[model samples]
Target: MSRDRTRTRERSGDAGEEFDAEFELDSELDPDADEDRTRADPDDASGGFRSRAAERAGALFAPRIFIAALLVTVGALFATSTFIPLPGAGLAGVFAAAFLFGAVLKDRRYAETVLSGALAAGGSAVLDFAVVALFGGVGLPLVAVAGGLGAVVAAVGTYFGRDLRKGLTQDL
Candidate 1:
């Protein structure tokens, strides 16, 4: 067999012998090397899927003015239902006022307005139950029925109120 020769370097450590190996540098890291490498566009944020997802997630928690308004309206409704029972006649006006207020001054989203109105109605119902429990002899079943009716009425009225506002705006 013909003699073969190849230069190599090795070091003997306490554990074992280690050989040195050569590694090639990437073209991008080698400044002196001429090569074409694609770079991302600085203004192209739309290319990232997470960017759009993050924006949508942020929109869900946007501040709403109607939440405080709902609580105040609920308290007022409770007082009315407690001291002045008018065969549910006052409920219509209260719900209508709340809906108009939300439609005109608060967030215009349909779901938000309807939910606020529903919550206000529920709060009024709870207050009615509390008053009855403390002072009156009405049964729990009756209180639940009344509360459910109030919630339904409020939700329906609020939906119509928002629709009316949208219609008026479209007409003008």
Candidate 2:
């Protein structure tokens, strides 16, 4: 006995989603006029200018330093609160810890990166949860606030720490 074969695929892309399939009929059925199909370039990058810019941004920022910093910040904040008295001083401690870590241990900014991630993730989540309980739902705004704070902390910490190490590296 002969059997027909069919293949089905569910496809999704930046533009949209689709379903495609190929089928084989035994003894080959004649092609139907209604079955006409057109082909489009799968790898086409053509999407106007800003669409292209968005694509580029997604490619660059979606996966790179920003995400890394967030992850690092949140992790660092969680792993250790460190020691600081004032709220402002607490933020300073966070940054200073990262800076000191990047400077002293020469730890390849892993310490700082984790710090940023922790701050972004944990600190933001905590703040949001706390505020929500106190003041009611503020929506997902907390994520943005936390993320922004994390980025600032990570960038400033890494920048100053790296800068501090520049000439000092010569001595060591």
Candidate 3:
């Protein structure tokens, strides 16, 4: 059995020979493919243009600054609700809060944006749920469904905003 195994190993090693595979390169290339290789004009300061929203979406994130911005936004929301007495403020505040949170804390990464948006929207939904339960206006089912939708909106909005930041960074 040992001799047979050794013979099999030797046969396999002999069979496993290296071969250099070669292929002919294409001597003729499409002219259209080469056209895209042209460099931008030296005089043009901007190498290429991306949307403004994409540019600002790339802003740096500092933990301290993010926390401060969030606190300010929360305070503003409370003040706006108490002193301003604006209708539809609750929904607006939620969206605005998430947007502000994302604007301050979100990095260019989509995952981070999504996470921030989800947290903001989730917080807003919880608050909305509590208000509804206390006030006894909107039903529980409606609140639940709307909360889910709001969360989705917040995440999508944050992602787009962050994506726009990339272009903004390039401009600066």
Candidate 4:
């Protein structure tokens, strides 16, 4: 049995030198032992089942920051609508809001900024629909378009904002 378990091979350059390697058959080891060791305790209070990505995402979308961003965006939109009587003013407000939000955050991750911007826009769209629904109905597809446009504007705004931050922090 030992001889069958052992493998022998000759070295290519060595003169009659042999190497032996031993391997264990599957039947010799208990597969359930590994499963038992790796399985997590169902009664454990610690969050051992959560993945790293989920943890990072949760950290990125902290409630305080997210709510602040949304409020800022909505306020900017309303202020722009009230003060500026021009086309695309709401979008400009969204861009500015996203830019400011990105600039204010200490963390360098842009995903949070972009997500906030998109959600803000989506929220605004819902509000718009709520108001318009009183008079007439609007299509739901428009809200999705607004969200996508918000994401793009947010990405651009975040890029410029981060660039400004970098420039300010750099040595002259």
Best by TM-score: 4
Q: Who wins the lDDT comparison?
A: 4
lDDT (tens digit, per residue) of candidate 2 on 4-97:
6688987776757787888766435534421321113334435344466897666544445445555444444544544433333334545655
Pick by TM-score: 2 or 3, better one: 2
- State residue 152's C-alpha deviation in candidate 2, in Å: 1.1
Instruction: State which candidate, 1 or 2, has the greater TM-score.
Output: 1
Assess the local accuracy of residue 44 in candidate 1 as a C-alpha lDDT between 0 and 100: 54
Deviation of model 2 at 150, angstroms: 1.8
Query: Cα lDDT of model 2 overall?
Result: 0.54
- Tens-place lDDT per residue, model 4, 1-172, is 2222545565757576766666545334665543343355565324445654577777766776767767877788778866897744676787888788767766764676577668767666677666663455554665677788777887788788777887888899
Report the alpha-carbon TM-score of model 4 versus the true structure: 0.60
Instruction: Let me know the TM-score candidate 1 reaches against the reference structure.
Output: 0.46
Candidate 1 runs further than 4 Å off: 1-63, 75-84, 87-90, 105-108, 131-147
What's the distance in Å from true for residue 133, model 3?
3.4
lDDT of 3 by residue, 1-172 (tens): 0111111222245668655544322223434332232233344324333333345544444455445544544554455556656643544444565555555543433334333434444455457567665577665555555456545655655555555555566765
lDDT tens digits by residue: candidate 1, 92-119: 6457656666467534444444455556
Better of 2 and 4 by TM-score: 4
